[model samples]
Target: MSKVRITQVKSVIDRPERQKLTIKALGLGKINRSVEQENTDAIAGMIRKVSHLVTVEEI
Candidate 1:
């Protein structure tokens, strides 16, 4: 599978619970933190769910 890097660029404060959990599941909590994940449909869905809170780049 291809790899993608996910970076938490925004705070989770006041965000929805589901979005917060998605960020955690992505291995990110604090701002500027990053996690590398496989570029799969499931992961892609999670990224899309919280797109406003993060930045994604192909790696």
Candidate 2:
């Protein structure tokens, strides 16, 4: 299976509550932190929710 590298490029300050929660759910709480996860629809959906705060690369 393919994987995705999700990096937190921006801080969550001043963002909506849901966005903060989503960021945490993505296993990110700090800027520049990256987490590898399976490239599934559920993860893609979560990434989409915080697209403004993160960058994703397929691996």
Candidate 3:
């Protein structure tokens, strides 16, 4: 399996509630914070939801 790096590049403030929750769920709340997760369909879907707030890189 492959892994992906999810980095919180932008602040979640003033964003929708869902987006804020999604950021926290991904283990990120502050900008520049990052988390490594397995590259899967579910994770991809989540990333799609908040693509504007995060940057993802395949590892």
Candidate 4:
């Protein structure tokens, strides 16, 4: 299965509470922290929700 690398590139401050929680749920709470996760719809949805705050690459 393919994987996606999600890196938090921006601070969560000032963002909506839901987005902040999503970032935490993705196991990323600090800037520049990257987490590898399966490339699935659920994850993709989360990534989309915070697309402005994270960088995602397929691996």
Candidate 5:
């Protein structure tokens, strides 16, 4: 399967708790932090939840 690079492009401070948790769950907290994950349904859903705070790239 292909992979995706998830990067936290924005700060989580003052954001919703759920959003903060989601960022951490994706292995990111600080700005520009990134994690490589499999391109799967679950990961896609998670990305959708925080689309405003991150950037994604297929790898």
Candidate 6:
């Protein structure tokens, strides 16, 4: 499988609890933080949940 870089580009302040949790599940907590994860269906679903709060790049 391929990998993708998921970077938290926005704050989770005032966002829904579900979204906040989704960001954390992606291994991110602060702006500018990033993590490389497998481009799996589960990860893609999480990214879709918080797409506006992050940036994704193929790695």
TM-score against truth, every candidate: 0.97, 0.96, 0.94, 0.96, 0.94, 0.98
lDDT of each: 0.96, 0.96, 0.92, 0.97, 0.93, 0.98
* Model 6 lowest lDDT segment of ten: 18-27
Distance (Å) between predicted and true CA of 11, model 1? 0.4
| lDDT assessment of candidate 6 | 0.98
Q: What is the lDDT of residue 25 in candidate 1?
A: 92
| Residue 10 Cα positional deviation in candidate 4, in Å, after optimal superposition | 0.3
> How high is the lDDT of residue 32 in model 5?
89
The most accurate candidate by lDDT is 6
Off by over 4 Å in 2: none
Per-residue lDDT, model 2, residue 4, is 96
How many clashes show up in model 5?
Answer: 0
Model 4 residue 28 lDDT? 99
Better candidate by lDDT, 1 or 4: 4
Error of 3 at 2 (Å): 0.9
lDDT tens string, model 6, 1-59? Answer: 99999999999999999999999999999999999999999999999999999999999
**Whose TM-score is greatest here?**
6
Candidate 1: tens digits of C-alpha lDDT, residues 1-59: 99999999999999999999999999999999999999999999999999999999999
Candidate 1 similarity to native, TM-score: 0.97
Better of 3 and 5 by lDDT: 5
After superposition, candidate 5 runs with Cα above 4 Å error: none
Error of 1 at 4 (Å): 0.2
Worst 10 residues of 5 by lDDT: 38-47
The TM-score of candidate 4 is: 0.96
Q: Candidate 3: minimum summed lDDT over ten consecutive residues — where? A: 19-28
